[model samples]
Target: MKEKLFRWVVKHRKPIIAFYAVAALVCLFLRQFVGVNYDITSYLPDEAASTVALNTMGDEFEGDIPNCRVMVPNVSIAQALKYKDKIKKVDGVEEVLWLDDAADIDQPLATQDKDTVETYYKKNNALFTVTVNSEKEIEATDAIRDIVGDEGAITGSAMSNALATTSTEQQISIITVAVIAIIFVILVITTTSWAEPILVLLGLGVSVFINWGTNLIFGEISFVTNSAGSILQVAIALDFSVFLLHRFNEERGRHGSVAEDMVQSCCLSSVAVFSSGCTVCIGFIALAAMQFKIGPDLGLALAKGIAISLVSVFTFVPSMFVQFDGFVQKSQHRPFVPPLGKFARLVLKVCIPAAVVILAVVYPARVASTSSDITYYYGTSHIFGSDTRLGQDMDKVKEVFGNSDTYVVLVPRGEVSEEQALSNELKALPEVKSIQSYVDVASPYIPTGMAEKDTLDLVEGEHHSRLVLTVTAPYEGPSTFKLVKKIRCIADKHYPGKAMLAGEGVSTTDLKDTITVDKGKVDLIAVVAVFAVLLLATKSLSLPIILVLVIETSIWINFAAPLYTGMHEFFLAYLIVSSIQLGVAVDYGILIADRYREDRVTMHKREALLETMEACTIPVLTSGSVLLISGFLIHAISSHGVLKQIGWFLGVGVSISLVAVLFALPGFLYVLDGLIGKTTLKAHFLPKDAQDPVSDTTEASAADGSAQ
Candidate 1:
């Protein structure tokens, strides 16, 4: 069956090539009409908890709910009040709630007994909360700059349509330029011909379009994020191109004719390439199981992108390679020995000791340094810097507001009949800085002529009530978790069976706690799943164990380095480390294992190991170097601490995995050969009579005669 399929592909190569060319062109043209969306919210399903909460809040609230908050420094209360009217007039703004104004009511307002309104007002900085109805209403952030008008520094909790658009555009631009530059560098290094990487990148460009076009057929989901998806696609697509070229070179070294070599190379490499692609695609597929909407959306996008890359590699790559066959054949080789020989030797000398040191130092260090704080992943620069608006405003707000950390208390109207009583009890809690509720706003001091009242007449009946409390400390670190627990305890004591916390800050804190508790479980599941696949692929229990050790070592080293760097967001780091270790590192193990088995059929065990390392080293190094460099370049465009940490860790991990595969795996294999006592390594299940009979000797003699 395999022989028939191979013969059929060879016979119909021209038509197959033409079909893919047309498909690529059509996809490219269709892409001109498509646009990519990067909104994080887009990843959530319409009914997901976060999305549902946002929608529910949007419906219940009379005014717009601010998504982006701004704080202006060095502004007087009077000066800030003057801009309120101007800010209200800004396009897309639904309402601007200023501290200086209160709407009149027909009924008397209730008064607070705990703290006088005057005292409360004096303690809190006067703030203007501007809210916009939609991003589409205001296309650019210039509208915001216009409203502020260079006046006394203006800042407040405000969502602007303009800012979102600008940020998205900036992110896209950065990713595009970075991907192009990295591809250029990779092309220069791998092919040494200026045109080769260019062609490969061109193929990648086509693949992106194909991915986009096919996604439309699948129903327009959220556009893949430029930062994660676009960059990842380029890196992954290049891997396929690298595999194709590497195999082409291998075939040309044995077969005399470029045309015949192309067919053989495609047949041999396609199996490994497709398998590697499946592993990557499956790594992403695991994201589908994530409860978060973004996780599944990312999974789908990556899965699609991997599929497109596989198709393009099989079709678009082969066409380009065939076109450049003569040029590829003419490229000179210096025949310098691969470093894997020395690396294998070094591994023999140091494998056990290095493994011992890694286990003793790196594993414990990683465990000790793991933290639950998500903000650390965002980095100190992004958290405190004034470059981005969020950073700038967060700094001002933190200073003026004391701490921007907030908590929410939800009360059931069944038990809590009097709003004042609930507010009073919550205020007495040590963690509560200030409370904002309809009941507090309706207090007599807010409307001096009104009398004090215990009940809110306007909002009556069994509706759920909410209290917005500002916490004393910043909403980061271990203390926040403790505060959340304490708040829950306070709620249980006072408003038993009637209250729950529901707000961005509270929900986020809960998520952090949940992730922390489930970290080990999730990691264990992912690792086991990946290991099962590796065992099936290699069909050797010892090999899978060796691969897992290499991967775990890489993950530990990758994670441990962040502790020294002062980067402590363990969850994101763990996700990234695990994914890369499983996806990219596994490819290296497969390459070496496949080569070792192939050589075992003809050579002595030691010679087979050495020759396998020699045959596979260049391709492994080429692919690994490209991935490492591209990942490292992610930091150049992103000041976001999480991205930088990921870039650094992933880059380092890929490089380290390359080293382990070249040294540790070979060393382990040699040790295994010694133990197994002359047992033959099993070759991959290939069809009989499908092997290429061409030899290096025959090709070399033909090349020498041609030169003469």
Candidate 2:
């Protein structure tokens, strides 16, 4: 069936080319409508306490959980109130809370509770919490910034997400251009023909654009998905075209026409490319199964991309090569990087030692990889690395007022005395900066006519009264999560099942809980799925073990680096890298193993490995190196901490994969060749004599029958 499809591709080269051309153009046009989601909170499950509380609050009340905080220096009570009013009037500002809202600012502020007053006003600086709609984050933040001018700093979800959106868009644009040029240059530097680089990139590029264009169907993707997916698709799937094209060139001398050569080339290279693509897809399938929605968000994008790239390689690549045969022939040049068949001699000397070393470190590397310091939260300050306005503002806010986090508790409106008891207990905690509840700030149990409007409006609600706790939780971490847990306990202790908690602290804590579970599950699923695919692809039990070990060891080595360096890895990057690196890096092992399986039909295990290295090294390393260079390039240019770490880890990850695949994999295959052959069915190469270059014979069948 696949052979027939390859023939169809060859016969209808022009139509295939035309379809891709038109599809690429159409997808590009549609790609613009695909939205990018910057809110990490949106990825949280609906059942999370924060999610439920948030949903309930949105439905029941006009007020929202504060999304931003603005601090202005050298402001008096009246001036601060004026600033509050101005911020409140901003188009997107639904609510802005300052000291005036809770206290009678018309009187001397010193008469009010010290902690309560100081939480909002300290060192002649006034801080205000601004609630803005998620959709208008950027516009609203911009308006808020304008109102504050140069003397103020704003930090919170609104501004953080705004920066996340804008910065990711800009960074992605720059990264795509830079990485493409880098890949092209590397391809040209290594390939035997100048046009080979162009054709390869063009095939991969069109697939990438088409993948992005197709994102319209999903409506939106996370910022990380769009940021990482496009480039990764190119890097991971690059070898498909290279392997097919090289095979095409090899077959060209025998065939009468370019179409015939391409058809045969597709036949020979199909299983290799398909196997590699399948393993990569398996990795993504595991990621898509993650409890965290962002896993599926990115997983589906990447999986779809690899699928599209596989199709492009089999169809568009063959068609374009045939169409541009004359140009390829015209531009053909001597290879700058000679075939690395000689490197097999060097690898033979070290393969044992390398494998031994890797085996010895396997347990430690695995342990270290799991033990590396990781952060679950990505605040704007952290993502921006304290290098931009958003980051700097966040730092300034933290410096001036310390890490003030707010938690909103909603309870039955009539339970004012219980709320007061809860508020008093919360106030007794040293870290609690202030508490604004109806019992403290308003005349509890009074008729509507007796209560002050501003104070009553701030805490009172029609169905559920709001209690705002300003605490020194320091944004998000183990300590903040601990505080959140303690606070939830306190709320429940006082109000029983009725008290609900919602805020950044709660959300971040929930994120921590959800991802902690997801991380291990994602890894397990990816390994098992990829291992299953390998077992089927190679048809050898031992070979699957060897290939998966090489791939996973390289990943372990990559992830374990941060532990040695004392660099805190982002938890998201950890999950993303685990899935992506496993999915993509396993290709190296599969490519080598697949080619080895093919070559062993007529050759001994040692000779098969040498030949395998000779044939597979360039494409394998070319693919891995492309990813390495791209990862490092992104690391260098990306300002986001997680993105930078991802790039670095992936770059280092591929570097490890290159060495392991090129050197250690040969060792493993040679050492375990007997087990491979014994566990396998009598192997027969696919394709006719035209596709099978080894020239089959009774000797070939005898050699194939042995454990390779």
Q: Runs in model 2 with CA error above 4 Å?
A: 372-381, 448-457, 684-708
- Scored against the true structure, residue 280 in model 2 reaches a CA lDDT of 87
Global lDDT scores for all candidate models: 0.58, 0.82
The superposed Cα distance between candidate 2 and the true structure at residue 433, in angstroms, equals 1.5
Clash count, predicted structure 1: 7
- Candidate 1 local lDDT, 1-708, one digit each (tens): 533554455556677667766777887677556544423333444534334445544444444333333344445555556666766676766665444433222222234232222212333344454555545434313566565544323332222123334454575567678668876765566554556666688778777767766655544344333345666777766777877776776677576655567667777776567667777777766665654444556667777888888877776666666766566546644344434567555555675565555446655655644533223421121222367655555565555555544455656543433556777777777667566665665552344235234334222223555565655555455666677677777777776755566443444554554445445654665567767776666566666677777767777666666556665553544564466556777777777776676666555555566667666776677677767876777655554444555666767888888877776677666666544323324543222233423344557789999999
The TM-score of predicted model 2 comes to: 0.94
Looking at model 1, report the run of 10 residues with the lowest lDDT sum: 375-384
lDDT of 1 at 148: 55
Error of 1 at 222 (Å): 6.9
lDDT of 2 by residue, 1-708 (tens): 877988898889999999999999999888899999888878888888889888878877777888899999998877888898899898888998888766777778778878878889999999898889888998999998898998799898888888777877798789889888988888887777888889898899899889989998888999888888898999888978877876776788787777888888898888778988988887887878776788888988898999999989999999998889899889988778866757877787788778887788788889888873633453333677677787788888888788888889888787767877888898888989877877877666776458887767777777888888888877788788789899889989988888899988788888888888888888888888888888887788888888888878888888887777777678888888777788766877887888888887767666677778887777777787888888998898887777888898888887887888788888887787777777767765332233333334645887888957
The residue pairs in collision within model 2 are 677-707
What does the lDDT read for residue 447 in candidate 2? Answer: 63
* RMSD in Å for all candidates: 6.3, 4.7
